[model samples]
Target: MAARQGRFGAQPPRSAAPGRRCVMVTANVDIPALKARHPLVNVIEASGVKLRGRGRVRQGVCPFHEESEGSFTAYGDSQRWYCFGCGLGGDVLDFVQQLEGFTLPEAIARLEGGHRPVPVAAPRPAGTRRPKSAALPPRDPALLTAAARFYA
Candidate 1:
C-alpha cells in the first residue's frame, strides 16, 4: 500500500534526509496567525477527533502520545496546544510536527496551502544523534522506560 499523505498533503520525500532537509518553511507565514484564523473547535471538528467538553477549549486524547486519560488541551484563544503527559507543547506548527511527523516547512505548507517547495537538507549518516549541549546531562534510559510505561 502507498504511504499515507500527511497533513501537509505530501508524503515525506523518499530522498529527503531527516535532519538536513529544510525543517521549516518561509517565515512570512506566521503559525500563530494561521492558527488564529481557525477556532480550536473548528480544527478539532476537522480532525474528526471527539472532544470531551463543549466550548472554546476542549480536552481529548493526544494524537502524538499514548495516554488513557485526556491530557491534551486545545486552546481557541491562543491557537496553541499543550500535553501535560508528554511535556510537548507549542503552537499549531509544533502540534502538526509532533502529531504528523512533518518537517516545519511541510507543516506550514500544508496548513497554509502554499506551493513553494522548501529546500531539503542532506541526510546524516546512521547512528548519529543531534549534538547535545554540555549543560544538559545525558538522558536516563530507566527514566524514559518508566515514562513510556506510564503513558502506555
Candidate 2:
C-alpha cells in the first residue's frame, strides 16, 4: 500500500512558525528512574522536617497546614508521601512539584541538576523490563509484632 499525500499534490512542506525551526522535542523523561534515584524521604528530611515513627513509614509535622500532631507520612520504600491532615498524596515528582510549585520540566531539571539533559529510556532489544527492588529490605514480622505490643 502507498501513503496518500495531502492537498498540496505531494507531501506538505515541513514548516514551523516563521522564525522558529521545526525542531522535534520529546517529553519522554525517565520518571521512574528519577524517582528511584532521588528518595522522597531524603528530600523531605533535607528540607528540615523532622520525621518521627518507625518502619517503612514515618510521620512528620504537616508543613502545609498548622497542626499540633504530625500527620504527614513519608513511605521510605515507595519514595512517596501523604498528608492525612490535608489529604494530599502522591509520588516523589508530585510531592516536589506541589511543594516547589514547579512545572514538570522544571521539577525534573531540578531533580536532575541542570548540568546534564535528561534522556528517554529506550525500549530494550531483549525481553520486557524486569522490576528491581528499590533497595528496601524485607520487613521482620516478629519485630513488628514486638513493636506493636510495646507501643500498645
Candidate 3:
C-alpha cells in the first residue's frame, strides 16, 4: 500500500509528527551491526566528553550527572559504557536513549544515522520444530564407578 500523503503532497512515514520525517521501525533490529558501526568510546567522545586512558576501557566524567571526578567508563572492546556516580550502565543504544530522552526506537533510529527503517522479518508460526542440539560426549564408566565407591 502507498504511504499516507501529508501536506505539500509529500508522503510521511508512520509515527512521524507533522512536517517531520521518520520511518516506522519494527522489532528484530540488528543490535550487533549497530554497535559495530558506532563504538561506545567513539560515541561518548563525539559528544564532547573528555575520556582519559588507553586500552579497552576509558574513564571520564559522568555526562549524565554533575561531577568533577571521573566515574564514567566506556568499554571500547565490548561497545558498552557505565557511570558509577549515576549508577547507569548499558550499551550504546541505552546511552543515546538516556542522553536524548528518547524511547528505545527513537534511540535506535538516531544511532542508525538514517531516516530509513531496518527491514523486519515476518513472524514464525507457533509449534515450529527447533533444531536438535549437539549430543554430549560419552562419560567414562570406570571413573563414574570409582567416584560412586569413594563417595559411598
Best by TM-score: 3
* lDDT for each residue of candidate 2 in 27-118, tens digit (9 for 90 to 100): 56677887877788766765556789777999987656666677999998777799999999887777667767765666777778853222
Which residue pairs come into collision in candidate 2? none
Backbone clash total for model 3 is 0
Model 1, stretches more than 4 Å misplaced?
Answer: 1-24, 30-32, 114-152
| lDDT (Cα) of model 1 | 0.63
The TM-score, computed over Cα atoms with residue i paired to residue i, of candidate 2 is 0.55
What lDDT would each prediction earn against the true structure? Answer: 0.63, 0.70, 0.74
Which of 1 and 2 is the better model by TM-score?
2
Instruction: Estimate TM-scores for all models.
Output: 0.53, 0.55, 0.57
Candidate 1 residue lDDT tens string, 1-152: 46568887868545457567643356677655776765555554455444677666778766555566778887766677787888887876676566567777777776677531222234445444424324576899999999999999
Q: What does candidate 3's lDDT look like per residue over 40-93, in tens digits?
A: 777777666678999998998776786668899998877888999989999988
Model 3 is weakest, by summed lDDT over 10 consecutive residues, at 115-124
Best by lDDT: 3
What's the distance in Å from true for residue 67, model 2? Answer: 1.4
